[model samples]
Target: MGVAAAQVVDPGSFKVHHVMFTELRKLVDRIIQIFPKIEAARPRCSSGIKALCSLNSAIDKAKLLLQYCSESSKLYLAITTDAIVSRCHKSKSLLEQGLCQIQSMVPVMLAVEISQIVDDLRAAKFIPDEFDEEAGKVVRELLQRGASASDSMEYAEIKALQTAASRLHITSLTAILIEKRSIKRLLEKVSDSDQQKKKILRYLLYLLRKYANQIIEEQTDDTTDRNEGAFGSNDPNTNFMHAHAFNVESGLENKGYDSHSDKLSIATLPEEFRCPISSRLMYDPVIIASGQTFERIWIQKWLDDGNDTCPKTGMKLAHLSLTQNATMKDMISKWCKKYGITIQDPSMQPDVPHLLETSSISIASFGSYINDLRLPLDISNISLGSLDASYTSDGSRNKNGDGLNLAPEQNSDDLRRDHSSGNASKLDLESLSSLAELDWESQYKMVEDMKNHLESDDLACFSMSSENFIEPLIKFLSTAHDLHDIRALKAGFQLLSTFLNQYRSGIRCLNEDTYSLLSLFLDSEVTKEILDIMEVLSCHRSCRSKIAASGAIISLLNILHSNIIDSRERAIKILRNLSLSTDVCSDLVCLECIPKFVPFLQDTTLARHCIVVLRNLCCNEEARASIAQTPGCIGSVAILLEIGSHEDQEHALDILLSLCSQCVEYCQLVMDESDIFAALFDVSVNGSEKGKASALELLRLLRVTNHDDRQQECFESSNVAPEDANNHAKEKKSHKALFGVKFPIFSKKKK
Candidate 1:
């Protein structure tokens, strides 16, 4: 039996086996050579050497089995061969396990190596060129041998090789099976004669199918979880599937694919076709940091919710950015197209770029036309208050010849009646005619009614201003006399002030004509409200020059001289705003307004604004000298340094610095006031960095110019002898003159 068995395994078969083992050994050696590179690429992969050892052992065992089969004729050779085959199988299994660990861990570079090896083996059919002659001889000898024995030997050898190949092949295939089409193509190329390889291919195909199915199930579970609050069901598809089933049954009543039929042809989609989060078909799929794919909206929501971990793996995500899964999206798109289902891509649509370009061009063209177009025509013809035709002379009509009436002085009863009726007349041609015709009392009553309406509902103010009523209101206020038309003037100013407060456009409507009218009333008793209106108007740059031109600075300065504290404060603020313009500041100085701010400087509430106004006025050299010459101005500013806030101290110090910079007398004045000098020194020690620096700079300047005078005064004040004072002054000069001089070390010297 041993002889027959040995003969049955032909010498040619042994030659084929020897060549096969040698090639496999060579392949293993090539793989081993790459191990160092692989290990270097993935030092954290601890199983690299273990995997290599398993593969090497399997290769060695296969060679041993082949050698034993070729050389021995012992009766126990078959038993020994079976034992070797079992060992080789075990080693191959271990190699597969180790390779799987390495593949899972070191997927980037090592995976490329394994993929390349698999591709080469599969393309070459695992047969080296050196084994060609032996392989041919083995085929001829197998033909000469009886069919049964030849078939048995061929099956054994091919089975062993297939087992080894399948184990290693799976490690490579498993890494890339997520690409369903690629896996399918590779499976189709596997040989049918090699059962082990075929089995592996089928198993991998099963895994890919299972993975796809799991995606659908996972999506369904997520959808169910999301809808559970509203639907009270574990299955999200309960309603959808039932409705779909009903629709199919109703629509295809007698068709073979009816829902009622047990053999219903339902399409089974792959898991990759659905989103892991929503359990719906993905229209815009994206990949996250965990290498899992989900719908873009669902994943974005997850990130927005402040979850920094991946839902699938519980791994902390390194990044919240999502990459578009273009491949998966394309696959889903193709599948949807085949099924005649429309899918809306959440990304920018195909026409979006063209639409955006068109919009931008249209906007640019419109802007260009606007730039070329003339300014809009002045629409100030819209009348604001009711007009009574009784006061106007027929020839003295407004330019528009609108027969506008200005309301005449009616009794309080008439005014109350007109307001209660809610019949505020709109501005029109007749109203303009009556405005010119109306007497002062009638105009007064008309404005009084409008003021009442404005106070009750401020929206009335918007309507009145929008109608171009500000011009008429300003004209009436300007023309009304302070003594006789005081009520009419107050009413008109009140109405205009409301317009200024309620609408910025109203302030803008105060053109040169309106400002001309405003200038006439600067000396009116209603100066407080007039100043209030000017304050709002000053905010607009266009109105500032007009207000300055209108002699508003003189009026504001007069208000500052008023005994009313509120009036003074408001006057100071308006002056401060007006002082922003150098021209306006010059105007204030020309009006001798510098002396007016001096008294207010002692008022702490008004000190900051007063100082600020003075600061602006002092920008001109004439104004600076004027401010320094203003009695008590220098003393008040110096006092502010001692008791003011940090900002006030900075401003005061700046004022003193400016004054001293201009005239040596002011510097001497600051030095003569010991409080001022002490304040400067104190600020140098304890003020803010900028303030301290300025204070130090002032002290340094004072010391440079008046050092001897200051020191002599200090000596005289302290009762030091004139001789010592002279020596002290000379020593101080010498100390400064010396460069890098160190003082003598003072211990209790020679004690």
Candidate 2:
């Protein structure tokens, strides 16, 4: 214990990059001080053991980040300034949060020490210091030059990067090769959805190889210049580096299919088919807010890192939902087939028909994972709030609280009611009508001013209750926009968005044109702005029919299929809001939106919205019947019960129960899916307080259904069996019609 505590390095003891992890370093000192008290007590409760292990995991993350910053190339570190600072802040947050969780769990004598640790955490602040600015400037110049330049200007550009590399102390071919590979890895991990960035990365990789070749190709007659076995005549890493330079020279130069090349070669895997996070061919490609597609696991990791931004474009995400990119996945599968290549999907494999099996985990680094529940010696014997159906690296999780959002303001739209008075708020309707007459440049400036007033002046927000308020906003936002119209449209939409967000009553003032105009802009530059206004407006009871009639739902269904995540979420939010109406629910069902929404059940950000929409729609018998008929919908909801939040899990159970209660055909649909059965069984035995009640209730409902079906089958069979005694096949099926579920869960006592 003493030795383990000693491993906590103080800020003063750091040998290099002292300013980088200053906050984390201060927290480490506090941990070291408290370690002695914890070591002596060694509290054995389940909570205590779990908290310690969680704290240990956080510490491991911090240590690895600190070590990587110290050993990695300074230029690489400098170029990724935001990412590095984000890591520091993330580690500090975890340490602070983990320490607070541990305070209550630790023994009484050590509780005060834990409190002191929290105090140290509160005082430390992590602010980004000025990094290696010269190195970053060199990278920027190189990328700009590479974007538009020829051999005539190549020598100057190449010389500039080389000089910067030398200044940052990167001199050897081995070092250059390492940095080049780092860039390649980053490129593969970042999606090509942002085309300009993809092009810039390819060019940078080409330039580094070009510089390395200079050292390899040069020969000297004197001391001025010499290149003889520059990478050493025999080293393996260097030799591999030399070969890599050749292979990448043309491989990344043009990202297109080479029909003349061997299709069967493993080297022929197209870059676009590979997942940004996994660097492997994606079986399940999902698009996020930046319009980039990534493997579901890695992108979820990006969100948990606490910045709700796209991995490729660095754009702020509207939400963390991942929409399935079916086109890309299909293309990937076809490409694999054409090349005679094989891929594995863990979910597709044949497995034991149980929920608590080993089919749940997938980690790149280790074969097994041991969480805090497993660490506690008495945990299994205690049997508390835990289940065998665990979520792994690819499973559902909450957004780390550091992001700007918390849960979508619960029932935010329900707070709005229509107002009749525009004159009471003193609106300038005449000035608002003149927006369409202004030129684009002048219009954008005017829109910016409006947004600033709305942002800074509380009275402007208060004026949103006026019936005429939406008229001016719509006049600014509703004009038919083009590519050239992006700035004014974006600014105008932003102003409208600000109005809707700041004052809840603005939604009450929206008109037919407001809902109808959104459909036209679905394919425009201001799609984000359009969706934002519609998401809030669709929540109003009176607006649902108009929003559906405008053909916006169909466009939203299409947006759900596209690779842009930002637009995808706003689109779904609108759909979810529209689903509140029974007529709109029927419309969504006819449009085939359930299958689209079901694919995102495992997504953390969008799961609640999906389930709530489904649950609300299930209240309508026609919609419930349609959901039961939809393939994979019930099964996906079952997965949600296992992976969703406590409240959502209960809602999932309610959806299944609602469908099953409708008829025996619906009950049979519930029984047909093995995952659904297993999920229910798991929840009944080991789910949350609310979830367990819902699961048991659903199971009881299913049992009553199976019993009625069995009685009917037996009555008919009694008359037919005397003549045809060999008809046990029908009887055998009826015997097992309960879907492998025994009725002991809620067994009735015999009188």
Candidate 3:
């Protein structure tokens, strides 16, 4: 037997059930001692073989039960103490009965041994351990309040959670995540037919989520404190809304409800999987006229009750019609099969009328086990028709019968890359690795000294053969927020820019947290250096949002408008990069940046840069309208067609197309500028292939929207060559008309 294997579980790990397990061990050991004598006697009668088989089955069951108790979650064991005690008594009872039956058939010596074992089993009384007695009292209190919709965060409930967490040794995030996964596995083990078991599992899951949420809130607050100090924000209104969005990313170590089991948790199940009326897993599912699904018997009963509202959405039914949802039936069948869940017949009454209120664990033990939720279970309260209108599941008996085949927990620490290897020289590797292990003060001292030597080193003309070596080292910049030394901060920002400039494509582990170090706190000492780094990060299309939120948008705007600045060019480039995200563009528009950006369009060197930024801003509806309304914004963009690069000319044409299409007035605005018509003619005939396509498209948009008479007037007003005008008119004649259709700004909407 695996009796020794069960005993291998750490004793402290199962503090609540220690006493029960100890008695179980004693009983199992006594039976093991008698097994040898029974085997040696080898009684040949049918009765002897039958009695021996019964004893063997009981022993195997006991071993498995012990193993389950040892390996299961401590909190699970603590709450299910009643079921644990009852099962122990039953295991002992069956063993005693088997021994009594075998006594008559066994040989004289073995029969004497069996009678003593039966006597010992009868003398045993299975009860919860001392710790379980306290746990039971807390559980009873929780159950009394379980009918409420809240998390029961009153002093008593919180104290109970805290006490239980301490007992289970689940103090770390990693432990909570592991315990959550364990409970989730147990939830998957439940059969659909076992509603009582499902409730207990659901309640446990709810409690664990509350605990996890509390931990998340605390950690988030700590990080927000550090971030606020680094950014120098004192506004009480400055809430960390981004951190609260952790439900999608930071929620529980990226387990993220990303697992199949999480997706199928009953709380978040596909609505169709549950019958709206009973708020239980649906069987014999049927779709009503409102397209909501329900169990056939419930829908039939609802119809028979003279009610006609869709139970889920509460809309009046188009008609009282029900169609069998074969698709739902098939899906339910596949889900049950995949998870090994058993669906019970909804029509059949459960064998135990009050399944949760077991004989061994009566609700009356808790004075007034009130289940009153003021639930309007019928037509009067449609809101109560929700699944959650019922009380939470708790303390009902769960069995470990078919048993669990739990995989050993995995350690992911080994999966991370070892920096000590790869193509870098050992000296370089040690130097890089040492920086990561240093305190912030020492790291600042080292990075400052290393940056100066790099610029003058013999290796300046050459690059590392492994090109990606800098990516792993980029994580060193994550500590930049903690350093207060100005020169060291400046040196770190310079290296960050250099790494990104040289290894942007190769970099895979860019720390967005490093971007937070870009606050105006260090503006006087390292604004130029940090702005340079932001310029590089912004060049990556995916990194723009983090850059925009890094507390430097104000610094960048100030640099843009400054009378004297050494970093204005880099500031403009960063803004251009951020313009790619429509959200950033809308922020710029709200800041009244179009008027500021309009002047940059006339500076030939900055014209291409300004026009390109405006072009990206044009992607957002508000920004597009703002640019159209800004005086000279359109003309400046049109100037890019003549003075800009081929790429810039294409962007210029795109901006005009956007302005023209947004409203009839902007279309006429483009028409009023015959210089733009001439630029369009020039681009249509001689610009790059894409530029020519855009130029023609903008011309077509102008022609389609202004109608032929208005377009001819704008063309007649232009001072274009006769031949170019004829060429433009001929091109327009051959193009297909798109009169009322609005283009989905380059095939997708941004922002």
Candidate 4:
């Protein structure tokens, strides 16, 4: 058996026991060679059937090995599986075969299996005297290499054999039988010989008889069950109706070949003759020049109704709605190359069955269909409250907080209805003509009256600036905007913004109405101007007071974050200023601003600005500590190291060092996360002497903690335990300067 296995690897041999497996591998290589020559070959031969068959066979073999290894413990199982897999991968065109081999090895990885053994040992408290120490060492190495079971083993085949031997108590010879069974089963499926078919039938019959009765008994239930559907079962034909129906051999009976044809003679070709493209009845097919290319006229007719292309390869047919057959042909060539499948003609294979299915358009196209069926226009009516702030802005208030001029004002609807004849709020240009009867100049004066009254900066103006009083303000803010009106528009929004911020959380203020006013300034005309205002407000001591106010500087910053029309540099600059602000930075942190900042690190244009801000924040002990605790800050630190400028790296090191000083163990915590250590390697190596000194110091601090725990023992020491000396060496390496400070030995030590 071993000699036969050895012969399978030779490309020239076909008489080996593994002949089927060897042929499949060679077939894949030949298919790969023919793939590029497809365009020049004869039609109906372009479908890369051979390559696909080989790939499928290799995958089946790998799956078999995995199954056999799971069920049996034997060294021969490992050896045989490895030998067959290695044979499958000896050619460049066998990528699919190699992938299958790699995938099979994953289940047998020594690192993974050993790790599992260790876990089982710990769980069951099983420790054979000889295996205990070696098992512990294996576990430690596995952890250090990231717990990948396969990675720790030098050879996956060896690992598989060893694990099966240790855990399942089976000899290597028995393992070989399981592997042989798997290989035989695969060959049974691929072979077309009558003898092979009989053998397979006998094997399957044995398996079914052995398991059928037990399976049936387990499925029997005592509990009553409801009917799942209208699958009435008494009539014999009821099942016959559900059984797959086949049409008579298409196009042949019409040709007077009725001698062997029954009244409705049906032809069932072997499974291999079924069209891989459209598995149904084949039709008018003409062979094209290619390895596996075939052109079928009326190809679209095979794809059920309303379909135009092949569902599997997206290939357009000779008679379809395709705009360009040549373009589609090119696309099909690329698709075949990607999947390594040959193109087959539906018409030429008259004996083959081509199955019909619905067209496989992308799901996104269904949404387009729904949208196309929607109404062309929609109308909705909304009622908004009156906008007036005169009570607080223009009205007189005394020391007792009593209103001096409190009078009811006319509602906008009443003015529009009594004088203009309808709701001017709902009016478009056509409806504006109905307002001709009203004193237009006087109505404009009333708007002026409302606008002036809402601009007051005092808290007494809260009532007039309430959300109900801001309707007119919203209308004015929503005016026809252009660069010409930008300054005027910015001034209006700024006033509305100021009024809302002062009174937003107050009893009379309407918070929702404030955002409506803020949205108007989102126009590109004045985006820059609004960001400038945000920058100024961020600098204000009073900015903190307005943090709870509706849509202040933070709102502006959010708008900036979302606006991509302008370079993100503008947004980053504004955020940098806000991040630097004593009043805003703390509030920003409280808002958990790391998510907003992290993406900016990825933006090449805004990255420098973001890094500067991060550096500055880290420079402050409190801010750096707070940022370190952010959800993604540890990952963000690694990113910053990869892309940050030299100065930024130095500053980050300083912050980390300061954090270490304040919390001596903090350094160890960050170092424990491998990603953080990886990040530091980029930044800590090239800094100035002072900066490098601090990094080394932080490293030393972490080492001392390791020393105290006796976790490592790889350093030189004569009297002290190796583990203790390892701790000392780590700490010493961390502080080169400190290590150089030598201690004197007394002359009495010579005794």
| Full-model lDDT, candidate 4 | 0.38
- Clashing residue pairs in all predictions, respectively, total 33, 3, 1, 36
In model 4, the runs with Cα more than 4 Å from the true position are 1-487, 490-525, 536-553, 560-568, 615-626, 629-632, 662-665, 673-685, 688-690, 709-751
Winner of 2 and 4 under lDDT: 2
Whole-model Cα lDDT per candidate?
0.53, 0.58, 0.58, 0.38
**Displacement of the residue 233 alpha carbon in candidate 1, Å:** 39
- Rank by lDDT (best first): 2, 3, 1, 4
608 Cα displacement, candidate 3 (Å): 1.3
Model 2, which residues run further than 4 Å from truth?
Answer: 1-440, 463-473, 476-484, 602-604, 675-678, 688-690, 721-751
- Lowest summed-lDDT stretch of 10 residues in model 2? 370-379
Ranking by TM-score: 2, 1, 3, 4
Error of 2 at 496 (Å): 1.3
Best candidate, TM-score-wise? Answer: 2
| Model 4 Cα shift for residue 105 (angstroms) | 81
lDDT of 3 by residue, 1-751 (tens): 1111123233333434555565666677677677655644546878777677666556545644564576456666776666677667766766666566666554544554665466456556565645455655565456545544344444555566655654444445566656655555555444465445455555655555545545434445543465477445533113222222332133223331223334346434566687766665776899899998888867776675567887668889989988999999999988777766666564543222222222211111111111111111122211222223222222131211222111222233311211211112233323344666677676665665445434322122123322333533445554454544566666677765554554333334455545665654325667777777677677766777777676667677777776644576677878888888877887787777788888888776666777778888887888888887889888788888888889889888888888887787788677666466667878999999999999988878876665654456466749787787778666543211222233322222336
